[model samples]
Target chain A: MSLISVGEIQAAAQRIRPYVLCTPLIPAPWGDRDRPLFLKPEGLQSVGAFKVRGAFNAIGRLDAATRARGVVAYSSGNHAQAVACAAARFGIVAHIVMPRETPQVKIEATRAHGAEVVLCEPGRREAVAAEVVERTGGVLIPPFDHPDVIAGQGTIGLEIAEDLPEVASVIVPVSGGGLASGIGTAIRALAPAATVFGAEPELAADTAASLAAGHRVDWSIEDRNRTIADGLRSQPSALTFAHLRQVLDGVITVSENEIRDAVREIALRANLVAEPSGAVALAAYRRGATPPGPTVVIVSGGNVELGMLAQILTG
Target chain B: MSLISVGEIQAAAQRIRPYVLCTPLIPAPWGDRDRPLFLKPEGLQSVGAFKVRGAFNAIGRLDAATRARGVVAYSSGNHAQAVACAAARFGIVAHIVMPRETPQVKIEATRAHGAEVVLCEPGRREAVAAEVVERTGGVLIPPFDHPDVIAGQGTIGLEIAEDLPEVASVIVPVSGGGLASGIGTAIRALAPAATVFGAEPELAADTAASLAAGHRVDWSIEDRNRTIADGLRSQPSALTFAHLRQVLDGVITVSENEIRDAVREIALRANLVAEPSGAVALAAYRRGATPPGPTVVIVSGGNVELGMLAQILTG
Candidate 1:
């Protein structure tokens, strides 16, 4: 895939202007050891994650006829909720399929946003989503693959460049590689001097393996499910893999412990709530990856369980 | 004291442009109820509170000669740190007198910014700060007084109006009344339709009393200061009182239970580590303040103890 250009990113910004927030690029806490940390607070985005951008962009582009039939998506939380929310905004129905173990908070929130949620066994989410889409004649919205979704996600990078063009490095935590790929594509073109690194939890290092091996790789969910960074569990999609190939400088992995510590560090030092996945990038930066100078860390999401939050903070 | 005008606030926004962040106004999570709750997020300001606006606005106006004598202040934490940090930016010597019980984290953070730290008994904070000013010929930087401080705080109201002019009600947590007075003044001027309610902890309801009695009321600092909302314990200053009398629509007291619950609500729903004082305004809104339609809560600060945060979240 050709890398996303600055012009494209600027266009994405314009397209997403009505639906997205120009999320602030805030300086990290003053007590940091190295150069300044500019946090791209994606947590402040609509639906409380960067996923909304992609969700809205995709849903917005659907033909009126298609929107009338609604859309279907499968994910544990962020993407599932984002598409559901975007559908509601456009007055379209959303069918979200999630695993049975999906958190009650996420399921209820997704349902409340006008999504008809279908729960399935861990291994059957995609099958369940496909069945629903087939039965209902609904279009399936892949969490990360579609071009509109990628463009929507790329808008986050546009905001970053507009907000802090002088950023030295853009560190983004990776899961299905959707966010990292989209942001990296934009940064490579808009802020050429800024290096982009994809961060992954050590427990869920499929993206790192793919980067190392130069091919798409799949790691079983159970194999990478040890980390509390729930959002980092997915292996990269083929589309994201292609984009990462062109734009990302490298992939870095942080331990589950590092991710947890970084989450606490964000709460204590930066005074922000960072979910485990969101903290991976900052964790890699703090542990001294591609460093020194103006670092931009994408704080990916803020959807955390109350029990987990207490656990993270108290411990 | 004359109320700070909307026009003046616009000017202050320009004046302090180089010094502080026009902190992001973050929207609460989608499940965050009928009236959308947008936070002014004073927590993200340069000094981690809205105090920086007042501190820098005051410090910015000092004559060159007076600036050389440096700035002196007294507080338990946030304002002391704010003054110290702001003074550092202008190359001014900051002499901060804090209570002996002031956390070492704050004391070190202030001193790390090159401010002189003087620790005194809790009751002697004001006297020690006065003595330091008198002996050193340093200008006393009142934590929440003077025209510039009010003007600085008034900038928040200006931003609020600009960000959400149609907002129907604003809930501001009041301490010494600097923030409430300035925000109220600006809100009334710029967004005349918005109702500005002062939120206070019932345990430290001095501002509520002062507003009712038409004078500053001294609330005992030693009287069961067990409420997690530590920052709202101060009595209202005369300058703040003068502004509050002219601007605030009403004052509401939140119980200790409500304050903790509010803090938790912000953490869970808003995904922000709002300090107890910061959560008070939201507490008022959530605990039934039927002022108007759309409500904007000024989440005042993010300085919080990790243990306290854990306790709040667990409950």
Candidate 2:
């Protein structure tokens, strides 16, 4: 499989420039003195996640007529909101298929962006989304499988490289692997000396298992759903797995307790709220998995529910 | 009394470029749709507050010979940490005087920045700081009284104007008024049409009272200390009062409940942790005190105690 080129990511960065924020690489002095750290807080994005980069890029890249027909996506997480928001900004309709068991707040939030939300039974979001695409003649914008989406998320890597040219290591959360793949590709091209690592909850360590086995490995949805980092439940797609194989130096699996501790520490010390999924990179860093040098951690998202955040802060 | 100039602020921005993060103005779509809100999260600073801007500017401006003699500051809050970090960066000694009653976390944070911390009785911090200056022959960097400090804080206003030239209004939390004075001055000069407002807790609304009376009003520290926004207890110094009077379009006071609500809202919706003092600007905006258009609120700091933050989040 061909990898995403630096040029594609640069183009995506340009395309998404007007729509997305250039989140600052905030200094995180609270990290180990030996391994200085900075946080690329994509949670500061308007949609509260890095998903917007891919969503906007994918939607923005569509031909005028196809884009006018709108787009379709399936997710009960940040991707739903990202596509909805991206489509709304482009004045195009978005049909998002979500699980019926999804929280009302999530549904309302997606709807608030003016997306047409289609509810489906659990484990049937893909079939439902396909049906919506068939009915509406809208193109499917998968959460992380497409090249446009991966290239778009890679813009963050470009930013990290540009902001800290001396960055020795980059740690990003792994889910469907689009984020790590995109960021890793950019870093490999631009900051070739920098080592790229993927972090995920040990409860859902499918990527680690796959990388260790030197091939794509599948995990049952029920098994993946065991982690508190809900965003990490999805296994990497073939495209993302290929990119991950090319770009990643290693995969670090953090315990659920470590993820919770990182979330609390990030809030109390760094003054930035991190969802469990977003906090995994910092958790890995805290566990001394990353090398001793200037490191950048992608705080991938912050769409955590308030009650969950409070529980983590106190726990 | 003279106010800080945009030219001075511009210079300070240059001097502190390498030390401080140019925090992005995060778009907070969760705010009122018609009035669009953006949060300038200064809490992302290494010291977790906007104080570093003033601290860095003040210390950076010192003559090489004089600066080599070191610096002294009195605070039990973010200012202490700001000065300590700034001094350490400049490779100069920093003697921070804190009240003996200060939480150990704050003292330890200050000392961790390589500062010599001197603890004194609650009412004697200033006197003790003066004695430190006398003994150490270090220049005193008053938290808000100095022109350089005000100019440094004003850099935030410069950034707001530059990033959002059409900004309709800018609100800042007012304590000793350096932040408001600095930001207001920049907005007044660069975005003259933009109304600059000051937000403060009703429990410590001396700035509002003073503005209403057309003179500086003094509130007893005992009365001012009643609010959870411990940062805003200090009354504005004459220098800052002059700038606030010249630049402010209005002063908005929020109740304690309102301040707490804003903190929770900002954390939950904006994914940025704001201290009660920092949240007051958002609280004031929520009350519909500002004119309609794109509004910018300075989230001045995020140094709230974790217990307090938890209580506010749960409340």
Candidate 3:
């Protein structure tokens, strides 16, 4: 297992500076008096997620020979769009394997980025992606497990440290754990005094259970799929689990109602559009799961369908 | 009538730098094929509106003795919150005169910022504000007519020119013409090659009609109030009209449906929440009013009521 270093994250920042946006750290209006909260709205990224940072960094690190061979990725959401967009920028061919049940908006967004969309049956995304890589001789870019991807995501933590050196705590939404692992690692190196907390939905709380048990834990796909945070269904890989254990102080699990309320809070108070997965960190913070201080909540993504957002907002 | 100059705008930017946010310009995902659109989301500002820029600059320009006397302002929406927030930052007393029928949310937000909210009859807000200023001996910071206010708002254009020197056109929402006048003046001075256009709802197209007739046109309050964009009901002041005539190339009037569509589009495509008034520029741009080039649209504010936003999003 290769552990990522702060130097690698710093290098990744420099490499992907031109490709990714340095998303603004917006002050949350309803922050507690004792702990002023700021939102790192990665939803404002070009691909509408932090996945762009990792995608660009991983693709940019490829040698000339590998770059010519192109890339293959599997994602039902933001990662697909990120890989497709980053590949387009490099003028490399990309094959994105997505589940056939994925939202039309996500599928269309991926295709719009000039990637060949290969729809596979549910739970066959990984197999389809492997096949594409084998047949096309393309480099496979896993969403959250690789060193380059983790380093790319760490760039966000680097930015937070640079922008707010006095940051006391950082709350990040955890899925396969690339975002939390990268951010936590960067914060550990750059702002060691600041604690890092991972936020997971109660319905898909494998990370919390795993962290508590001191090992990798697996939840059935049906069980993980119960949360409205569709992007956070994947279990953490061994590499990401190792990074999380080293960097995170603890994990916070939020209910479905908490996530819904957080989405509304972000839209109303922060004037930001956040998908359910993107708002989990804020949900955890609102629940007082983290210690008080100058806190930063990472709004992970904003690829929500219109109908779903409307229903949540109205409901 | 003193018109705002680029130098004054530059000075205002410095004065309010500590109080106001230098908002980021986000690239719009659904921009035209020929003209790429960027959104300057002032909604992300501390007060969730560009009004904070003018309010801060106006109050900051006051002498120490005058600042000690505190400030008074009249507004039914964003401006009230702006004055209150800026006053709190400056540690000065704020007396906000709002309409009796003002939304409870706006009223609460103003009070929450530590301002004394004085409610008055809808059309008598100015009279109530004048009385408050007379009684408390507070300096009056009118929303848009004052030179200091216009100069402060002009800072947006300065930032736009600095960030996107290749910008060819600017689309600004025209409510009382303050935003348009200020932005137009700055763009005219800083980026002379760029053309400035004002966007207004067809129901309240007083600015468009005024510009076409070469004078400030009057629209009855009832007629103007028929539009969903409540912030745009006010007609342009004589001072603002003079500036608009000198700076604006044209005005675009959009339908009510178009404004609603723009609100949804900003939320769905750009992943940013925008009020109906703030979304007029994009609505006009969508209607093909601006020429093909790199265009910047000022998303003036994002203080939309949650229920209204839900209706717009769902509808």
Candidate 4:
């Protein structure tokens, strides 16, 4: 399979410019002084996640007839809202399949975007989404497996390189690995000297295991679901795994407690809210495992349930 | 007194570009449908407030000898941190006088920036700051009273107009009126059709009352001290009041409950943390008093105590 090109990522950046926010690189003076830190707060994007970039790019690239027929997607949280929101912006119908166990806040937000939400039993979202695509005659926008989606998310890496050309290291949260694949590809093409690291919850460290074993690896759904970072439950597909293998310098697995602490720290210190999944990169960075000069951490999403956030902040 | 000129604001914007973050205008899809809403999150600034703009501009413009002599400032919260951060960047001494009743977090943040913090009685901060300046032979940088500071804060207005040219209304939280004055000047000059409104807590609505009476009016410190918005207690100075009279379209007062609710709403919906004072403009927007159009609300700062933020979120 051909990897996404820098040209495709640049094109996606232009296409999605009107649809998504170019979130600023927030400087963290309180961060590790020797390393220096800048947070690429993709959480500030519309729908409160970087998922909008990929969703909009995928939907926007579709021919008018296909786009008019609508789009389908499956996600535990942020991507569902992204596709729903992107579909709404295009004034097209969207059918979103979400896991029944997904946070109520995510489900409601997807519905709020005027998408038709279909909730299936745990571990059955993809199958349910495939059925929806067949019934509705809509194109399925896979959360991470598609090239357009990867190129769209790659725009973030393009932005970080543009804004902070001297960035020595880049850390990104890895779940299905699309985000890291896209960003790592861009960083490799644009800032080859900069190290790209994937951050994962220890409970869902399939990527770390896969990278070490030199092959794709999958943890049981039961094991992945143990992480509070609900978004990182999915394992990488063959295509994304290939891209990750080529682009990533290393993978850092963080504990559940560290993820929770990073969320609280982001809210208190950076004055930005990050869901547990989104805080994984910061958690990894805090562990001091990466070579840091001027580092950038991708704060990927903030679609967390407020009650859960309050609980985390309290603790 | 001569009001802040747009040219001066432009100069300040250029001068402070290297020091401050150019916060993006965040789109709010869930906001008032008819008017549409965008947030200017100054809370993401390096010092966690818009105060850094003025602080950097003020210090950056000083001659080498004067700057080397050090700087003195009195602020209840955000401005102290801003001055300290800016001074530290310039490798100069910063002596900050804060009220004894100020939040411990603010005091600690100021000290963390390597500034010398002096605690003063509630009403004696100015006098105390003056003494520090006298003793140290340092130049006093009064929070919002000086021209450079006002012009620096006005950079936000320049950014808004550049990003959203059709902005019909702009609201900012009012404390000493420098922010409103500066932004109002920029809006008047650049986006002339845009209405500028000041948002204040009803408990500390000195600007509202003063606007109604056609002159600067003072509310007793005891009365102004009743609001949870510690940053909005200061009244407008003569210079800032003059600018306010010329540039303001109106003033909106929100109750204390409304201020608290807006803070929670910002955190929940916008995925950005805002202190009570920072949320005042948003609170005023939610009151449904402003004319419906494309509205921009400045989220001024996010220096809330984590415990207080947790409590507010729990509500």
lDDT of each: 0.82, 0.91, 0.92, 0.94
- The order of the candidates by TM-score, greatest first, is 4, 3, 2, 1
Q: For candidate 4, lDDT tens digit of each residue in A98-168?
A: 98898998999899999999989998888999899889999999999999999999999999999889989
* Candidate 1 collision pairs: none
Which segments of candidate 1 are over 4 A away from where they belong?
A: A1-8, A29-34, B29-34, B224-226
**Candidate 4 chain B — worst ten consecutive residues by lDDT sum?**
B26-35
- In what order do the candidates fall by DockQ, top score first? 4, 2, 3, 1
- Tens digits of per-residue lDDT, candidate 3, A65-110, equal 8998999999988999999999998999999999988888899999
> Lowest-lDDT window of 10 residues in candidate 3 chain B?
B21-30
lDDT at position A200, candidate 3: 96
Interface DockQ of each model: 0.67, 0.78, 0.75, 0.83
Clashing pairs in 4: none
User: Each candidate's root-mean-square deviation in Å?
Assistant: 1.8, 1.4, 1.2, 1.0
* TM-score (2 decimals) of chain A in model 1: 0.96
Q: Estimate each model's TM-score.
A: 0.96, 0.98, 0.98, 0.99
Model 2 regions lying over 4 Å from their true place: A101-105
Q: Fraction of true inter-chain Cα contacts (below 8 Å) kept per model?
A: 0.65, 0.74, 0.70, 0.81
TM-score of chain B of each: 0.94, 0.98, 0.98, 0.99
On lDDT, the candidate that comes out on top is: 4
Which candidate do you rate higher for TM-score, 1 or 2?
2
Question: Which pairs of residues have clashing backbones in candidate 2?
Answer: none
